[model samples]
Target: MITAVSELVKYYSSFVDAELLKAYLAGSRSEERDPMEHIEAGVQWICQAQDAFECGGVARSYSMIYQPYFRKSGWFAPYPETTGYIIPTLIDYARLVNSQELVDRALRMADWECRVQMPSGAVQGGMIDQASSPAIFNTGQVIFGWIRAFHETGEPAYLASAIKAGKFLVSQQDEDGAWRKSLSDFTMNSRMSSYTYNTRTAWGLMELARVTGDEEFEEAAIRNVEFALGQQLENGWFRSNCLNDPSQPLLHTIAYCIRGIMEIGALMKNQEYIARARRAADSVLARLRQDGSLAGRFNERWEPAVSWRCLTGEAQMAGIWGRLYQITGQPDYLKGLRRTNAALRKVQFLRTDQPGLYGGISGSEPIHGMYGRFEILNWAVKFFLDAQMLELSLMKKSDIRLQSNGLGDVASAN
Candidate 1:
């Protein structure tokens, strides 16, 4: 009740200030509006975001949201966590179109992350300035980029960095496979001390295990995944998961858990694990509004906890659905994937005069909502690009305009 009251107080207080009120009104209009007509424009926005950060050389993240009040001369600062994982997207896009531009960009990002890595093989949480402390989660994400870089260019440095990070993860693991120390702010709240979404770290470890043929890494990854699996309720709810709040978990964290479980399941060929992931995913799919937007937060019962949608979560879920459909041959999953992707596409502001808003996905439909209020998040654009790319791989186009039957047959044909 206290949390609820505090949130309500925060919400109502937004109207008291003129700047906040103006921002909220503009966001409200953006939310109710239709999606842009072209997926190309959103793709352009994603490229712009990448370029926006590339000016700094390592192609890190933008430190500030490009807004009137928040505008600054130089905004590029490499966010180690997102930049680490963003390598795969850049590499994938580069390979798809044979674009050396993207390949060079990916190489620069990988090199930057490797250069900034802590001696202990960990990356810091938050932005470079704020995340001065070593964090296991951030390190795991960086390992992801490093591993991909190794595959793309066979760079010894990338592999070496990934090995260091993977070893660090193994060294930090508890007997029960849970990471008890070096946590990010996402899981350091007083209300919770651990998060199930660290399954993402486990997922990264699994990748390392595959490449290095290290049984220890595989065992550690599986141990952590087992820990996450134990948190799954019968109704498919995952406990102690969220970026900030545990009581009301964000769909973004939930998708992270689901995707991690699904990937590891595929790797280990564990049908039960795959089934469990699908069950949790189905619960989320059940809550999708007819318009394809999902509330950012959900309760244990899979009920909406917030009216605003988390654009990042929506994109992540689309990728999850796309992967599920590819694996399980589920028609509903493909349908939901397309619908959700379309809804996200609709929300992309192709005609925006504001460069910050041009191709960037809003953190929430109304920019003033709780998550990334009045800002365009780098990860939002990253996941949005991911989903679009996944959709393109499933079907032959960026737009989800293919027939349901044709799309459903993708896995079978492959």
Candidate 2:
């Protein structure tokens, strides 16, 4: 009881920044702004994050609070895992805006990734300065950046790097397709051994297969995904899926799981994989609040595990829901997409004096929430841009009109 009180006191006492405190007190209320404006701000913030470190990779996050224990605050070191995925987002945005600068920035990031690749062809976990151990999930993520970079530049080096990373993943897998080794040290716990969320890693392998026409990579990806599907319950909840707690998985990891299955299903033309993904997506959709907020974590029975909102997860679900609508032509998925995106826009800081917070999405809705407490994460902004871009694309294609309130209604579109 004494320890709990002490911890709570420490948490509150850490709010030394008056400006950040004011922003926290304001909560995640929606503000009226243009989506493109938000996108541009987010892109600019990301560029700033990349420049924070001497390396060309994106910073892990920007800390809003000062911590004496870590003896450091502000933009963190370059993170290879997120920087790998951010490449595709930057490239997509660059094309949309016809900006060669963003394209060159993404290529520089890709080149840095290749230089840091471990001798075993795997990427390290955590920031560049952290322990240089090879991680399964991180390696899988870097493959995405390399693959996209290869397509963009037609550079043999990018494909070569991707192929090496894919081989390392295949070599580390057990006979049952689950990876019991090379887990990220940051997420390691004595109780958890296998992570079902590695399905995202499987998606990367499948992409390599498509590009290289290697049946070995495709077969390995299939085996791993099938293993993950076996862990799904009748209610669509996955066991052994969370980064730290499998009993109450974060919505961020949940979205990762669903997206991997959904994309792989579409690529392979498998109805079963698509159906499984739909079941999980529908379960999460049923839990969305009227204001478009979802609990940061959920239990196996589809119950909310926390009051705070995981904004990154919500942005990811927006994209997933949008894709589902595209696949099934379902109205509910479209409604979900609009509601979630609307909620995110409301919370995004447009006029903050802090460059780190401007147009950047917090890990949680409230600045001090548990997910990425007091920090603005780069991945959050990346997902937000992707979801908003998707929503705009679909609206344009279907001739949907945006309402005065910033959210468009499907009834009006028809």
Candidate 3:
């Protein structure tokens, strides 16, 4: 009991700055603001994270408070797994905003990834400083960057890298479509055998299949997705899905699973896959509070398992909801998208003097929540920007559809 109190005191004492204290006390709930402003701030934070790392790849996170145990703070080393997927977001944002600098920066990130890739064609797990070892999930994620880079520049090098990574993924995959080997060291011990969330990795393989016209990649992706679907309960909660605890899975992994299924469904034009994804998405949507916040974790029964909010998962779900709106023209999904995005915008610190806190989404709301615990995560910002961009694009499309249907004034009001 004494140790717990001491730890709490230490945690609070780390917030030495008055500004940080003020921001913390302000909490994550606030009035709706412009998403584009938040998007811009998110992009700026990402750039700073990259610059701080001094490598083309973005840093893993920015510590907002001091950690007495680790005696560490500030920007962390570049993470290959997230950095791989972040490439596509950077490229999409650059094109949307017409920024050549960001485009070049993303290409450099891809090059850095290529430099550090293992001879086995698999990307290393954890940060760059970690011992070099092949990781199945990491390799699958980096394939995303190479695929996008190749499409953007018609670069043979990017294509070659993607093919190699895809081959590695295919080789590691089990006949049942599960990946039982070369899992990320960061995953919990209980989940080492297989992860349902690797459906996201399967999505990466599917993307490669689309680019290379390789039936092998497509078949492997299908097997993995099928394996993941088998883990989904009738209520849409997935078993053996969480990185830490399967009994109570983090919403971040939940969103990842749904997104993989959704994307693959769309790519393959399979309505069954889309419907299955919607089942899970809808279950999650039902858990949204009236204030638009959701619990960071949920149990197998789809009950809230924590008080804090996983901001990363919220942003991801917003994008998923937005996509569902586009696919089905569902009003509830549209409403959920707007509500969640607005909630996210409110929490974004647009006026902060601290560059680390400015524009970067915290891994969890309240900052000190267990998910990321006082860190602004790179992937959090990446997913936030992606969601905001999707919101903007979809709203514009919705407006056009409404206008063409003779609801011009209604569209104008929105």
Question: Which predicted model would earn the best TM-score?
Answer: 2
The collision pairs in model 3 are none
Error of 3 at 352 (Å): 1.0
TM-score for every candidate vs. truth? Answer: 0.84, 0.92, 0.91
* Local accuracy of candidate 3 as per-residue lDDT tens digits, 236-307: 889888877889989998998998988888779889899999999999999999988899999999999999
RMSD of 3: 4.9
RMSD of each: 6.3, 5.3, 4.9
Candidate with best lDDT: 2
lDDT of 1 by residue, 1-414 (tens): 986675666555534654334444454123423232233444455466656654322323332233332233224455788878877766666665678987787788888887888898878777665647778778887788898889878989999999998988898889998887878654456476667888888899998999999999999989988999899899999998876777789988999888888888877888988999998999999888898889999999888999889998999998888878777777788888878988887666544555555666777877657887656666787787778767666776333322344432222110
**For each candidate, how many residue pairs have backbone atoms clashing (under 3 Å)?**
3, 1, 0
At residue 133, candidate 1 shows an lDDT of 74
Clashing pairs for predicted structure model 2, backbone only: 30-346
After superposition, the stretches of candidate 2 with alpha carbons farther than 4 Å from their true spots are: 1-14, 27-30, 399-414
State the lDDT of candidate 2 residue by residue for 66-150, as single tens digits. 5443445788889999999999888888877789999999999999999999999999999898888889989988899999899
Ranking 1 against 2 by lDDT, winner: 2
What clash count does candidate 1 reach?
3
- How high is the CA lDDT of each candidate model? 0.73, 0.84, 0.83
Ranking by TM-score: 2, 3, 1
